[model samples]
Target: MNIVYWALVFFGTFFFMEFMAWFTHKYIMHGFLWHLHRDHHNKDHDSWFERNDAFFIFYAIVSIVCFYLWSYEDVWFCLPIGLGILAYGIAYFVVHDIFIHQRFKMFRNANNWYARGIRRAHKIHHKHLGKEDGENFGMLIVPFKYFQK
Candidate 1:
């Protein structure tokens, strides 16, 4: 395929994966998998890379499988899609854990609108503690209603 074709495929797959992530985090992780993800919200001096980090481990395995499929087909198109996943992973690590939570105190201040918005949205997600969970599901963008506080 041409470069433009590859770019389109990569970005389309990337956005789909991101939407999947949001849905997974909201429903799967926050719902049935709460036992595993609870560690993220629980106030404790656990490692900066809390148990919730296991989610990335699963993601890595899926990426490897996707890469293998693409390689077998000689498509080479999925390489950029994998790169997009890596980019989103890095952004999630930096923005969600490191900067927003101040897990490592990496940033003195998160002054950006996106940062503040997501942080506030995540805060709301934690407000109910358990029952009324699954709100503010977006990792990068807030859906306005989440910040109604």
Candidate 2:
């Protein structure tokens, strides 16, 4: 409720959502759901929003459920958690898909370390298949171990 409380809630929810995303991406997306995710790995020179974007439909359902739970419990604090998840998804779409993959030319002129690093990490992830593709699983936040190479 207060400004400080809201700030804490926002930051806490952001990190928690990031961790949850990392876990889901590392396991669920790469594991059983690989059937659907495999389309992402296959190289196809086409549109910016590829078949892999379908994963966002599942994410939207999860976001709706989270918001519903937060509303039902009158836990306004958790609303920020839902927002954090949405924010992370948007960031991933923009950074990973659009910028790194050159899905869109919006950032073509922008040269920066963050963009370069993300592009490099994602390239490594796409270089191999199966367990060898484990590197750079995190979208926005790169784990230190992924860069050891």
Candidate 3:
């Protein structure tokens, strides 16, 4: 059942990314490295990108390293782990950037309560233009309070 084990690992990585994202957002992004993440909270004109995007590069490097381990070093589990990280990255981009921030001008009319809740929670997080007092750091899994009518 190696295939099944790898599949479970992949899915586990997907869920694990939520915690990683939250921790990185709350601690790393909102912590001393806020300079890199500052523009995400406050806009930098119509630049269409933020220094915050560098966080994606960091994760990309992690995935790339995992791929290198899988291919060159024969660390077999790294393949599924890398794919899982990539998948989570895609989902985070779609949810946080596309759906919540409307960066690409899509998903504006997603009227479902879950969609609404995601938007609401992200809005709360963005309400703090400074790094000090942000909340709702998670993406796909948001607070139940946001889901209430």
Sequence-dependent TM-score of model 3 = 0.96
Query: Candidate 2 overall Cα lDDT vs. reference?
Result: 0.71
lDDT of 1 by residue, 1-149 (tens): 48888788777776776787788787777888877787777746546667777898887877777687678876577677776676677777787888877767787575666666677777777776663444746577668764433
lDDT agreement with native, every candidate: 0.72, 0.71, 0.91
Error of 3 at 29 (Å): 0.3
TM-score of each: 0.82, 0.78, 0.96
Could you give the candidate ranking by TM-score, starting with the highest?
A: 3, 1, 2
| Residue clash pairs of candidate 2 | none
Instruction: Tell me which of candidates 1 and 2 scores higher on TM-score.
Output: 1
By summed lDDT, the worst window of 10 consecutive residues in model 2 runs over 140-149
Top-TM-score candidate index = 3
- Angstrom error of the Cα, residue 60, model 3: value is 0.4
Clashing pairs in 1: none
lDDT per residue (tens digit) for residues 77-139 in model 3: 999999999999999999989998888999988899999899889888888899788884589
On lDDT, the leading prediction is 3
| Clash pairs, model 3 backbone | none
* Better by TM-score, candidate 3 or 1: 3
